[model samples]
Target: MNDHDNNLPAVPEGDEPVPNPGLPPHHWRPTDVDPKAEKRAERQVAAFFGVATVALLGFFVSYFAFQVGDNWDTIAGLGASNLMLGLTLAIAFLCIGIGLIHWARKLMTDQEIVELRHPAASSEEDRSTSVGLVLQGVDDSGIGRRPLVRNSLLGALGLVGLAPIIMLRDLGPLPGDKLLHTIWKPGMRVVRDVVGTPIHVSDLEIGDLVNAEPAAIFELDDEGHHVVEGVELQIAKSKGAVILLRMEPGEITPWKGRENWSVEGIVCFSKICTHVGCPISLNERTKHHLLCPCHQSTFDLADNGKVIFGPAARHLPQLPIEVDDEGYLVAQSDFTEPVGPSFWERDKT
Candidate 1:
């Protein structure tokens, strides 16, 4: 009935007319309109990539320069080694991201395109054409022809691979015979951890649990002692730490061949969980259950640290204990069997 109705496209009696909105005006970028600006942008992107290469090289240098245990006070509580390593590696990744963005915005072709709707499945001809387009893009990247860019990218990637290799240091040296031994020895006094004082039977009470370690494990001889320092100390302590729990004498049920392993009602078991080597000490005195916080593996302290519940595949290894003439508790000997989680080499024979 009006100019608007006359201009609108014809529609079916009950169908709605489609709305029309023209595309927005295009605005050309500085690099797109100027050749010199384009070249400058390309160089700026390349410079960013160059800086990224240097940062990656610095990452490798920091990896080897700083020891894991070095003092951290040098950088406002951040270790010098960690600070440099993190900064260099972070810059390396950040530069690459920024460089790629700059290259896309300034150097790569930018044009608006409109594609009509098509079926989800592509025709064989369309597929072949798409493959050709991908190949053409790869060729345009000049990765094979530009030795400087190609080599730098390759070198950066190679340095990145070193991160996982360096982390492998945490897996540690093959445990070997180390897992089979500890600081425990004949007549070595059992001492409370931290305070390093020898434990007497009188120091414990019924329903009491005390976390203890071998006195010799923490002792320094006149010329200083051997074993249990650095990585070795951490590994040894992980497998050697024990919990001493005292129950009512009538409540104790000793394992066979372990009748004399306890001093009075005081019994000792590995603090390391049997499930996956978590240091377990949570005690339920009324139930005689020692719970591992990691996986909730429960062991019965009254019944030789046997796995009573949860995912533990084996029992907590028990240490033999006795009172010496000096009235302090001491190990009769080192653990008769391996402690902590079971290993592939464990009990193989």
Candidate 2:
């Protein structure tokens, strides 16, 4: 009826005509209209990719340059190895993301397109059309024509994948027989933990539990320095730890061939729980039960360290003991079986 309505497309009888609003006017960007601006933008995107490449190189350098706990490798109160690896890797990933964004925004094809709606289901024609569109998209991305940006992006991604592969070397050279044996050997004197004082049978009372370790832990060399120190000392102490419990001699139910393993009424067993290798010391003196605090795995020291309750599948390993000439308790031999939690090769023998 009015001037605006007159421009509308004609419709069938008795049907209302729908107004059509066309797309907005197109505005050309600086890079789209000018050659120099396009070149500058391309350089900027390439520079971002270059920075990403440099950051990735730095990541490799940092990975091998510093050890985890080096005394001199501290930065901002954090370990230099961790700090540099995190910082460099973060910068490399950030730069790669930014470079891709800049490339898409500044250099990729800029246009407004309208596509007619079609059926949701696919057919032979739709599949062919989709393949054509994918090829067109690849061409529009200009990756083939932009060698500088493409190569740098490919290099960064390749390096990122390679970094993880290099770290797989730390998985191990295999523990071999290390877990099968410990620092405890024949005639190793059982001393009180922490204080490192030798223990005599008279020093213990009935129903008493004392945490003890092997005497090799406190042995001094000719220079007066501990023979077992550093990481070796820590590993030895962990695997060689035991608890000496004194109960009435008649109360103990010794297993076959273990009647002489205890001295008088005191018995020794590995402190590590067999379920998950947690250190256990909570003792129920009334019942002679040793309870692991971590998961409630209980062991009865009076009955040859039998598993009385909880999730422990195996009984605690006992250390055969006898009194030395000086009355100090000593191990007759190392543990007959391996101590600690279950492992893959544990049941092989």
Candidate 3:
């Protein structure tokens, strides 16, 4: 305002605004005119791409160099496997971004081009003009003239693309035999689920139902540590989970050699439903029938946990139990069959 105001001659009171001054003069960069500066910039862009390639290589090396549970491979409490992967992958991505930006800002054309807006349905002459302009812009990008920068960028992109494929190996293997077993064993006390106290046979009266789990999970070693913690404990509780019921021993129709599997009038059966692995606990006390809440499948708990009605194909597995010296109910051993839904390749017979 001040520069224009001082240079202008005084105007009449009711005249129009002063004549407009157009854009300022353009400032040219050394690379825009000097051959030496342009060559230096081309090399600099290539160097950035080269660094990206090295970072990608480091990503692969870090993946194989560190094992997941190794005792010594740690950085700031994170596993070396995780820490190295994050850092190397971050650097790899950052370098590519920086290289593309530098190439666009310095080595590419600095001239400003303008186009006016037109109708959406362009005439043939306008369409031809656009195609020619696109070809001319491609020529200005200097890909043919700059082989080093172009080749380095392509190599960097190709190497970075393989990172995901290499890490796919970490999906690891299946559970194998782990899913077929639980922590229940001979003499493992039947404990109340949340309270973790061993259940005495005398404490449960006739027609009582108790949701129970294995005591091995709550057991402590010499150092006062849990014998089973974390995922192993969770798995044990899920598979070994059962509901204890007290019925008249005279009413139970045990199959073949399972006559002594129960204690007094108390019996235990797996809480997992056989159809789709849902947990079953709802009971019809008078009929001694256990019902699955998910799909209403019912089992006769009084008759060797046999399927009485609904969708379940197999019987609910019964755990053999006996009274210990302290009168607490304990497992004679593990379940004789798998407790959950049928799996593919399972021997149904």
Candidate 4:
């Protein structure tokens, strides 16, 4: 009585505060109590799996239906093949994921259990128990017992793998000798890009850098027939692309064979970078240096486009130029050497 009286003086037993009321009442799911409801859920999950199978089949059909290259058109300019393939595969995976979630929530055992926190280090017994739980989960998944579902899912996944292998065909016909040449031919007129105006030697002044393409690129007959189109046009334009620069004649140190290649201080070189094929136009007029923004590879336009600095391993390819009888700038010939990065097949001659 003495101990109880001393402790109870601060708060009377009749006035003690009430403890918190916890979470809301738990309601049993329809599937938990109704056998018919559970069966309906199982049918819904199976239907989802069936829909996923159809979506995967659609992916395969889309892959073969679309053709590659110029004749290929797109839906609103979005590649039709890519759009269809991506949509179908995404739907297939989504259906499988949704089906699994529905199966777990509606069909699998859903009883709630409380797990107490433990010390950071686990005993050997606890580790073995954890491993056993994982193995039990594997057995419960029914992946081994249901041969039809397992085989069908495996078949769908295997077919998905083929999509990438089929895409390997896009890697190429191998560049071969294609990069070595462009539409640039002997006497082909050099024209201003976009405007398609033929460039005259007199039109350029010292310290000027002009982005130019071959006149043949814009040429069309009276009947609107292009001399080249489709793949051929793309290949030729890629190789033949060039930049024209004009410096004081005294500023240039022409290589022996290229002495007459320039007209009135105007020289031309391949716009493609020797480092990695990035088109370059950043020109330092005062130093006669052209810089590639991609890797900062610099070339001395005054000294045969020799790599003066940065990571460029080779010189930019020079396009020999001469003024034709009509006074329009024309290619003296194709680049004596290949343009862009150095390759194994490059013969230094």
Candidate 5:
């Protein structure tokens, strides 16, 4: 019916004629047409892989060279260990990606192929053909022909995996008996947490709850002694923290042998919830119940910190307390039991 229709393929009487658009002419890249350009592209790809190798080497150097929190090992106010590790690892991955792209675009075959649609399941002969095609693709990638690219890429991959293994050192020397102890010891004064002022049993009223810590955090000997500093101080405070509450002595139902653990009506227990180690300060003062915010695990302070509700497997650990000659509350000794979340190796014995 028209000039466009004249180029259409013929059809049977019942079927409509369909247009046949011939494939466009394939355009060749500069590397395809010129031997010199092809050689330059291959060298460029090799150089990218070489850079990847160098970046990976830098990563290992940075790992051992920079100590965490070292003042001299900071760049732009961020830790050099973190900054260098991130940059080098990113460059190592980026170089490999860029090199692969350059190799595919410049040197690898770019011919148009037609793959007809077929059923999902293939015959045994088709599977064999697929394996042969995979080998053919590997050969076409020039990895066998190019020793430099292959070796450098392999080296980069092998070394990059070592970065994580080196970081295992940060897990620190095995815990040993360190986790079983804290800054709490005999005669350590109980002080308010943030202000670090010594607390007296007479200072608290009935139904009063105060978050407190060890007095070693605030005191200095004749020569300005330091009990704990930096990370050690933080770890000590976290494990040694306590909540001091004043309730009617008649309301308290002390456990066996713990009858003398409290001073007057004032009692102290660990602030860390036995359920997942959440900080619990929420108090039901009238009922003498301590509620953990994380899991709603409730402990009865009146009954030796017994688990009254929720999913906690252990009761809140109580600290032994006695008033010093100065009338200030002090620990009789360290916690008789471990505090915080329970572990498999914890003293079930």
Candidate 6:
């Protein structure tokens, strides 16, 4: 570490700047020597752009083929939609960059030139010279002579620009008050999720947890077909899902003015987590704690759905429930507060 001398020779300082060292010797690429090699390089660059085009097409296919939740396939715990979209978009952009770099290094002008330093501001003559140099550079690029590379680049760029424009359809006319409310309303019966069978308070036993959804989700048309289908059905189910849990009445601590919210010992809370909206029902019966498998957020079902532990910042939303005239458990009204993770207009409600 101490082998080098600490003191070094110092040169005299002057007002005049150091003389220019000049440019290094230019090295010609293989593409510059043989016409066959030049043609091969050109084709290679175009092939990269071609691959980019194919990747963009695959992105579009993945967008349409794979629905977000129920219809999506999975790869290593990641949804195929997410995986394909990210992979394709990354490849598209990467290929474009590689193609441009390869074109510059192998085909574009390689001569070395040195320019003396000049004032920051340019005169009219200097500006004209700069414009001429830019035009000369374009000519030296051979873009006009090589129609294959030029057209391929233009096509790839056009598709790249078109991809985002296609996705702009997701920005709707606006959500209005749609997201502020769910399918749940006063007197709406709480039913099991997939089977859509109405649940009675007597059906639940102590320490039982049942996944449920709003009865409106099963409304039949004149032909006995479900009225809520496709994307609308998915949205309604996501926003209206709840869990019916039965614990000892004495074990529950009702929040202010919420004493009548539960039917006997059966209390209802939104299944969606407050942290990031993952469905949560991993129950600890002894402590009445509901844990989210996604992020380990925990909530206490016996105490107004309070966040008892983990990453959840807010309590799980409680759904007020009462027994119907027919002995079925039904909602008293829509949730007093919006459920699920926080959103931009969540506080507005």
Clashes of 6: 0
Best by TM-score: 5
Candidate 6 accuracy as TM-score: 0.52
lDDT of 6: 0.88
Stretches of candidate 1 off by over 4 Å are 1-7, 10-51, 66-87, 90-114, 117-132, 144-148, 161-183, 191-218, 221-267, 276-309, 336-338, 341-349
Please write out the lDDT profile of model 1 over residues 40-86, one tens digit for every residue.
87677667678877887787777667667544334676777778878
> Any runs in candidate 4 off by more than 4 Å, and if so which?
1-51, 63-95, 98-114, 119-128, 159-182, 192-211, 217-224, 227-241, 245-266, 272-287, 292-296, 333-349
Worst 10 residues of 3 by lDDT: 14-23
lDDT of 5 by residue, 1-349 (tens): 9545789655657543444455688999999999999889888988888888899889889988987753558889988998999999999999989988999999887787755566799999999999999999999888898787788778878887887887797888788877677678889999999898999878999999999998765435688876668787877887899999999888888978999999889999999998799999999989999999998999999998999899998888899999899999999998988888888778642
Question: Cα RMSD to native, each candidate?
Answer: 7.5, 7.0, 9.1, 8.4, 6.3, 11.0
- Write model 2 residue lDDT over 103-196, tens digit each, in one string: 8988888898865556799899999999998999888988889888788788888888887886785687667788887778778899999888
lDDT per prediction? 0.79, 0.87, 0.87, 0.81, 0.87, 0.88
| Residue pairs clashing, model 6 | none
TM-score (all chains, Cα) for each model: 0.56, 0.63, 0.56, 0.57, 0.64, 0.52
lDDT of 2 at 189: 95
Query: Could you give candidate 6's per-residue lDDT for residues 1-349 as a string of tens digits?
Result: 3324656544457433556787787778899999999999999999999999999999889888877756668888889888998999999999999999999999998898876678999999999999999999999999999999999998888889989986885676567777667888888999998998999888999999999999874565687966777898888887999999999999889998999999889999999998889999899988889999998998989989998788877898899999989999999999988888978656622
Q: Give the TM-score of candidate 4.
A: 0.57
lDDT of 3 by residue, 1-349 (tens): 7546789766777664554455467778888989999999899989989998998898899898887764758888888888888898888789889988988888777775544456899999999999998888777888768999999999899988899889888798666876567678899999998898999988998899999999875665687866688887887887889999999889899998999999998999999999998988898998899999999899999988888799988888899999999999999998888878988756674
Q: Stretches of candidate 2 above 4 Å error? A: 1-21, 25-51, 66-91, 113-151, 161-185, 193-197, 202-208, 216-239, 246-260, 282-288, 302-304, 333-338, 342-349
Prediction 4 global C-alpha lDDT: 0.81
Cα lDDT of model 4 by residue, 1-349, tens digit: 6657777544457553444454566768998899899778777777777778888888878877886678775878988888988998898888888877887788666555545566799999999999998887766665566455556556656666776786676677766667666677788899887677999888988889999888764445698856686787666666677899999988889989889988889989999998888999999989889999999999999999999899888899899999889999999888888888777777544
Model 4 residue 236 CA deviation (Å) reads 8.9
How many residue pairs in model 1 have overlapping backbones? 0
- Position 7, candidate 1: lDDT: 98
